[model samples]
Target chain A: MAEKRLMYGNHALVEGIIYAGCRFFAGYPITPQNEVPEYMSIRMNEVGGVFLQTESEIAAINMLFGAGAAGVRATTSSSSPGISLMQEGISYIAGADIPVLVINIVRGGPGLGNIAPAQSDYYQATKGGGHGDYFTITLAPNSAQELFEFPKLAFELAEKYRNPALILADGLLGQMMEPVEFTFEPIDPGKLPEKDYALTGCRGRPRRVVRSYDLRPGKLEELNWKRYKKYQEIIKNEQRYETFNDKDAGLIIIAYGTCARVASAAMKMARDKNLKVGLLRPITLWPFPKDKVAQLSERIKDFLVVEMNCGQMIDDVRMATQFRSRIHFLGRPGGGVPTPPEVLKKIEEIMGGGR
Target chain B: MTKEVIVAGFGGQGIVSSGIILAYAGMFEDRHVTFFPSYGAEMRGGTANCSVVISSSPVASPIVAEPDVLIIMNEPSLLRFEPRLKPNGLLLYNKTLIKSEPKRSDITIIPVPANAIAEELGQGRIANMVMLGVLAKKTGILQLATLKKAQRIRYKKASEEQLSLNDQALERGYSFL
Candidate 1:
């Protein structure tokens, strides 16, 4: 059934988490993302789950450690500075190989940035903000429907790799309201399979230990290598991106999240002018969708990278193409969004004013 | 067909809620709709505005750089947003609250005495419903019947009397032209 309803992006994320069988949510109140914790306060209780308004972002992530270590699907959300404070805890979670969901409703940043939408944290979320030789599965959603659907996918991916998953969204997507069609049945956490590594009561089984450090000699190296193999497998298996009007095109626009929506509008404008312009939107920030870009480079040459930041994801696109680099960037730092007309102008300039 | 509308006024006025009601009604009629509020520190007892998009196709960007229709509920918002109105667009302002007239000659300008009409029906807060009624009768974007149903969802806590007051305000503005 096409079960559609109008809801805010943050509220959709909460419902997505609850529907994915997440029984525990811990978060602190922050602008653009306050709705996540605020809605959780009520919906978690209604779903017989636990919602904690923690004193700080640090406490929230550590609380998630306790719940996640016990084999419960636990999560926490915050904005830029708050995400920064959770770095140590995230490193701890990564070190212990825990499956947890962390959401960053990103805002303009570097310091105490204003509460407007920005994608400045692309490097932070994808390259592992916390100190470790570890990577989290990162998913970027562009619409309210995708916001509603990505949580379940993130949870499954996190559990599959026994790693953390980050949903890198922005304030614009969080604050906007749109109709969302629920696609999946609500998952029942009760009937789910038991996690073999959980520190649940050691009633009949041997006591299990979960820790990030193996302090004995080369033991830490061995554990790091093991996680490396998992990352390699993930890199080989998981790379998600979207393409529009890519065939027989000379230029393509690469963006993600809110930026991609604007790029799409610009691409439509280009197409209306009969320009051979296309769009490539990466859904998964990690694993980077490099292979697709590399393949598309064989046919398409010029690429425009639009973002709400000065330029972060542009590095990934450059590395993906490797010296065939005809990449142009349009960015609006400090929480401003680039409009379709401005983006179209860039596309036209890159296209020599026409195809 | 796609229609982008911006509703602007002071904080207490139902500017954001009016956008939501329009979007909600658009959804009921099988149209793709998006409502985005301009949320900032400026919204605290200050000027507030919101963007609403109703489209036959999927909506692209939630931000409205150019609006097909501009609904001004206060004096400050008229000059702030009037320049962004599309050529030959509709400029609908509340005559009761706004003293300045739109100077655009290309666009169709309508000044509705929304506050006065709403006061005649009891509350000045429901003047947004009056503006919505004018928008409905002019553009054919949404229906008054569907909007009434959508308001019940938006004002779920409103008493029967308040709801009836809103319906009358809409009815009065719908035929007031």
Candidate 2:
């Protein structure tokens, strides 16, 4: 039987990491995500883990990079501007093939927008925020239960691919409280193969240097190609999404994160009014789930993309449909989230045009 | 059945805590529950509110636009949330703090003098608990036993006397109507 516990989404993510055998947490305090570090600070000691409150986001990511390089399950979390600060370090970690968890409890921003939830980081998170030819596996969770389950999945994927993984949650999900049944069991951190290539005081074995830099030109190209090959393998195998009421529907709404919940509610309202609207929620943002979108295009007449940011994921929806189907966008940036009624209005407008 | 509730009041009036207790009671009974606080740039002594939803099935939206039950702890909360309550909804307010009569006739309004009752109990802060008791009795969303369980869990860290005071406040408020 699953243990039922009521927790904030941010706190749930911390519990997920702990269950995933994450023993090191280094992060700076930021709004909407402060609960994560606050919980970790209190709970890490009980589990004999290390929790560091870094002076800056830059310092925190680097600390995560160091801990990850030393082969410990480590993570760091921040909001939009703080995520921006850690871009270079994220690129370096990916290039070095180190497994780390980067959590962005996203708030609105081009630069310091506000402390409200927004999906504005879609591009920055999925399209490689830093200077790199690499992609981090980005998981988007809509509720507190998913928030509890995704971190363990993130860590497993990160370790399997030898790359970084991101949990892209928003302020609403982070701050809200809900009852979540934890599904994953705790694992012993000592039993994992984290020490195989780790720089653990190499006495008899060869010293392993974990780094992203290659001074020679040809060698760097070879490394980049190898990384790209692995990323391609990830793209082929790791796409995850959920389709709601769309198998026989005419119109599909593409949404992710907290916006997906609102879109789901809107779809329910539309169905009540005899409008055949459905929802396609992307659980993984980086892999994009393009194949699923393309398949749905055969039956669906049009698509509506809802987001907290102005038209970020809509571009991906258009790309997936190849600009063949009518794709529309409904967004609210700089703070507020779209409600079900607002999404229902947009759905009705699209249904009017589609018919 | 699904129930959407909005509890609104001044920041220190325990509006958010009442929502938490309600949601906790729902969850303890094996129902899906969500509690969303109005946050960000919100300061103490300002308007504060939270939305709580409880359902047998999964809750689709945490945002409650038209609540089935609206609890107003102050005048500003009354003005702000009165128009948003659904038709034939349950409207519960603190009659001691709110002087004006409700304008709508379709909804069932329960007037509980929670502040006066809490004052009589020798602690003004327990007014929210009194309101919670009335809510438990009037709506049947939570049973008196479930409310007591929730109160025990919520104040597990408090002294025994404090817990008893809250229980007294709750019993007083539940019978107020």
Candidate 3:
């Protein structure tokens, strides 16, 4: 087994980036997620990587675009409002077929809402926030361990499909500390596969172009169709989720990120009192894990959807179950987080006063 | 055994650091632990608090709604966290700073003169360490040796003399009657 160390979620993200061979980072500082860039400023130097404290999120994301286009494992991070600034840059990156990593350690939002944890950016992240039709492969991790582990996975999936990847975390997950064991040894950047499409100056070969626009008729439409095929491949192969106590559950709780941890605790509390409560945690926000939710809804008639926002993920649950599973919602928008007891009470209410 | 704890104080009181040290000590012993803190404007204007969950089994929620252990380092922290303690839980307050007594009769409350003890050993900032020592002795969840080792690692940049002062403070608080 690997050695374990207590690490904060934000700092652990830097460690994960270093371990995954990401050598370029450009980010603007924001609260709750401030520790990411703060730690990156130090660790990037130690790892001999490029770390830029850009003047704005726009500058940081554009910097990421340039580095990623050059075939460097480039990344950037921001909170809700800062992330909104990166939208145009992200759309360009996605359209250009460049692999990049962007982290939104979300705080309460819509606009400078507060520096507290929230998941209100679900629609923005999943349904394509910037412009046109595009989706960043979204991953939501619930713990510091996953925060440390998901960077490598995100980078890998991004490179595999040559698409933008978003780590959709919140202030609570970013601010917490837990013991994390490094899952794999650090990868040497030199050992990673060379990119065939990178713009490497083309000294001896013919000139190449890496771009998102095409003035020629039907050229842009062809690119969109090709990207659509890749997305379908991802949806078919990459829907990830985790379930607890779902086999014989009378009521299943659907949540992700911070809310999932609270739901897990609530499930344990409900189980102690002989109430059959279960949990289904979605690891991917864009792929959405609709198949699993649909399968469970076929048998389980009761569900409680929890989120730290005004019922964002509940819509996905309702669509997955086709509005047949009697879904109950417990949403606390802005900065409010659901407690285990509060979730358990909702579970009791949904489970017909606890059988 | 699952021990949900809330340690609270002013911003400069090392409230967050003590919570991490407790969780770290538990992790060092191969137990599951989590430390979640309050950040942003709350820490700037009001009391700063952190929740720690240490359990033999895997910890689920990092947030503690009703804490079994509440360590209050300042008067404001006591006022903020006292109402949320579980019945029969343990309450350790810093007597040198907080003059008010707890109102709850169901929980066990102990007032430690953490600042006085740390001032005797030297700086007032190590009061959180003293409180941890009393917590270790009274609750038995954390071992003295583990706390010392965790303290060494957490403050690995400290000089040998400074480190020894911290150990002595923990010892003084541990031996407090």
TM-score (all chains, Cα) for each model: 0.98, 0.97, 0.97
* Per-candidate interface DockQ score: 0.79, 0.80, 0.88
Q: Rate the local accuracy (lDDT) of all candidates.
A: 0.92, 0.90, 0.92
Fnat of candidates, each listed: 0.66, 0.68, 0.86
Q: What is the lDDT of residue A102 in candidate 3?
A: 98
Chain A only: TM-score of every candidate? 0.99, 0.98, 0.98
* Candidate with best DockQ: 3
Clashing pairs in 2: none
Candidate 3 chain A weakest ten by summed lDDT: A346-355
Ranking by lDDT: 1, 3, 2
Model 3 superposed RMSD (Cα): 1.5
True-contact fraction for model 2? 0.68
- Over the stretch A56-95, how does candidate 2's per-residue lDDT look in tens digits? 9999999999999899999999999999999999999999
Residues B1-177, candidate 3, lDDT per residue (tens digit)?
999999999888888889988988999989999999887776454678999999999999998999999999999888888999999999999999998889999999999999999999879999999999999999999998899888898889999999999899889889995
TM-score for the A chain of candidate 2: 0.98
DockQ, candidate no. 2: 0.80
Taking every candidate in turn, the Cα RMSD to the unseen true structure, in Å, is: 1.1, 1.5, 1.5
- Ordered by TM-score, highest first, the candidates read 1, 2, 3
Candidate 3 CAPRI-style tier: high
Kindly give the number of clashing pairs for every candidate: 0, 0, 0
